[model samples]
Target: MLLAYIDEIGQTGAFVSPTHARFSDSPAFGYGGFVIPAEAAREFGAYFNKQKRTLFKNEIPEGTDPNRWEKKGSDLLFARVSDDRPQNLRVFRSLISKLDALNGKLFYYAAEKPCGTPKETNTGPREFEAREENAMRETLNRLARHADSGKQQIMVMMDQINEKSRKQRLPVMYAHILGRATEHEDMRRIVEPPMHIDSSLSANIQFADWVCALVKRSIEYQLVPTSRYSWIPKETQLLRDKEIFTFESKLHLFHRAVDDICHSRILLEYRPVIDPLHTSTMNEENRKNLSESGKLHSVNKLEQPTNHAKAP
Candidate 1:
């Protein structure tokens, strides 16, 4: 069984509109983490804890606690560590190597925020929530594909949210996308309903938090050419070389370019309708014209028109 430990970097609050109050440093929202075999869960947790202790060497800071000592991807990559960045990097690289040895793969999905209209900003909730939902759907799609192929099952373990209501709401939201009524629900090879855990106690969640932060930083760099974040490239390359990160999958459907391309290609496979009234009806005049020219074929070839108005 595959277990995907999922986490997100960035608030779900929309920051797309320049005039919006929430607009800040982050330009995109990222959801990603790591996946491993279910049987290895306990072993992975033990190994991760050992590595964390090794990095800090039990030298607990005077004021900082164990939770604060826990290595974080953002802090390791971006913040100053003992005034020696290279040394900090070495420790991080070592930790990654240990993870690489476990043969786990990284899964990520990022959605670049879209600028919204004034009306949208004031009336409807922003697109950030929708993007998050799409990312989850795509993640499940990949997991489902694996389960279908291997005849195995999977589940998602996510970091706990601060909000009590959201903690319960997220699982219900997942059900809408993965439950029996959803299209391609078979792809929800993630059999168990998703559960949330305290990152402070769960080594798996902590490790996943680091990976999610790294992916989010990398995405921020990609989306903004002039961004000054440096160490992201080096860390990103290491993850890539390990062959653990899965990039550029079908879950990037929210990208306008991808959506447009898919639309154009799918339209070619269906007959184009010139008259809306004749969409379902066979016009006698056109039928006779075709029959006279020997161009008429079996009417059974006519496919029921799909509802284009509802196309995404």
Candidate 2:
């Protein structure tokens, strides 16, 4: 019964940006995926609350903000930091520290390109369909490999986007993944949500909070230097899609248990820097900086109008 609840944060459609050299019409998009074990949900709530108290002792004070007090009791905390250099450096460092304490792993994937771009020879609906299918396949393939060896069942729940549309599409996506699994054969079950919850509160907020934590952790992981001892390669994209499915399935249940108690709103408070030019370190010429030729061009060059299909 390992279940993985999945949700995406960030806009998926078009955006307006005039300064770029390439596709002037498209928007920048990002994607994320998070997982946790079913049994650890409660423990995470308790531990998260304690960490909140430690981080924002001054903000909590004695008895001023009822919401703060309520959050403490509820075991919820939210915080955000921008992508600015020193600030992100500190924030990401702290995030890694918290992740170390939780002993869980986070995996994320993101890709951005111009909107209205067609895939293959498809146009409109067909194009969108192909792109979505490809994205789903890529994500599933990457995630499914993280599952534990003994488990063959993997349930995946995603935030229902128009209930009807998602309901119809999710099963298809599930089936598609299963079909793809023929090559691996380890995956046995696939589940999608609105899975039941016994708690009085909505799982959306809890899931949202969890997403915030994951986003912070992911950003931090990307920003900070990795040590062989501290890094969890298992959590990274090394495993097959079947394995990742197990990991995500377990996380789904874990989030449900903590949804009621955790302070999910903390994610809203986080100030994420949107500038692609920003770097994690203060060093002007650090090769790791986002401004480096390799990194920036990888994302930016993809947007060039020269790459666009010529109009008939």
Candidate 3:
């Protein structure tokens, strides 16, 4: 069996550009982490704990439990893309080596979000839930494919959230996406809906969060070059803007790291996918039109159009 631990990256809230007064949070939203065999999880956890303590020995509190003490990946990996030096990124390269030894892969799935209207802050509760559902379902589909290729079954684990109500909600949609009705849910490749654990208690989930953070910034650098990465020099001039030679160097490093680690199996989705449930019930022609437009628009609970993204 495969054990897949995952976590969220980027905001679920609506965002346009970095300068937007109300709605600027992230250019995308997605899930990321790594997958390994069930037998190796505990051993990997031990190695992760040791690495964490060593890397953050000065930062962690003296008396805090090393296993329970947590660090946000954003804080650890911030300014990664803008910086030309690849020293900090060695952590990922080391992680990739460890996972590769265990026959695992770094995994992530994200969708470029729609640019929202000026002054819009949130995508509203309904729209937020819809995006969550969308990301989870697509993630399952991709993971299921991986399991199928291996002829192995997999279980998903994620960090627990403050709101326990979602525990009841995420699984129903997950079962549906797996082609099982909620009432008659049975597993084939993916064992069941994701099991949630307190991140402080699980080094695996903590590692997942860090991987998610790497994916978040790498994707923001990819999708929103003009907005989130405006600080990076755009022109290719060695004499001028020497500190910031080009975004290409950043992109090159990003690609090298991801390609070296993922081995072409990086699962980050390029577009915000329209959930199949939303379109499944539609008549054939409407679905055709929706596909042809190359735009994915979302609907709010009140049947109003909400956040949307252009397909790339």
For each candidate, what TM-score against the reference?
0.67, 0.46, 0.68
lDDT of each: 0.57, 0.37, 0.60
Q: List the candidates ranked by TM-score, beginning with the highest.
A: 3, 1, 2
User: Which tens-of-lDDT digit does each residue in 25-100 have in candidate 3?
Assistant: 6766767788888999998888888888877778888888988998787776666334653433555456656766
Question: How high a TM-score does candidate 3 get?
Answer: 0.68
lDDT of 2 by residue, 86-144 (tens): 33233334433444354434444333334333442234555445545554554555445
- Model 1 lowest lDDT segment of ten: 260-269
Model 1 agreement with the true structure over 31-57: per-residue lDDT tens digits: 677777777777878877776776776
Give stretches of model 1 more than 4 Å off. Answer: 16-22, 58-69, 79-84, 115-126, 167-171, 177-185, 247-312
What does candidate 1 score on TM? 0.67
Superposition TM-score, candidate 2 onto the true structure: 0.46
Candidate order, lDDT descending: 3, 1, 2
- Top of the candidates by TM-score: 3
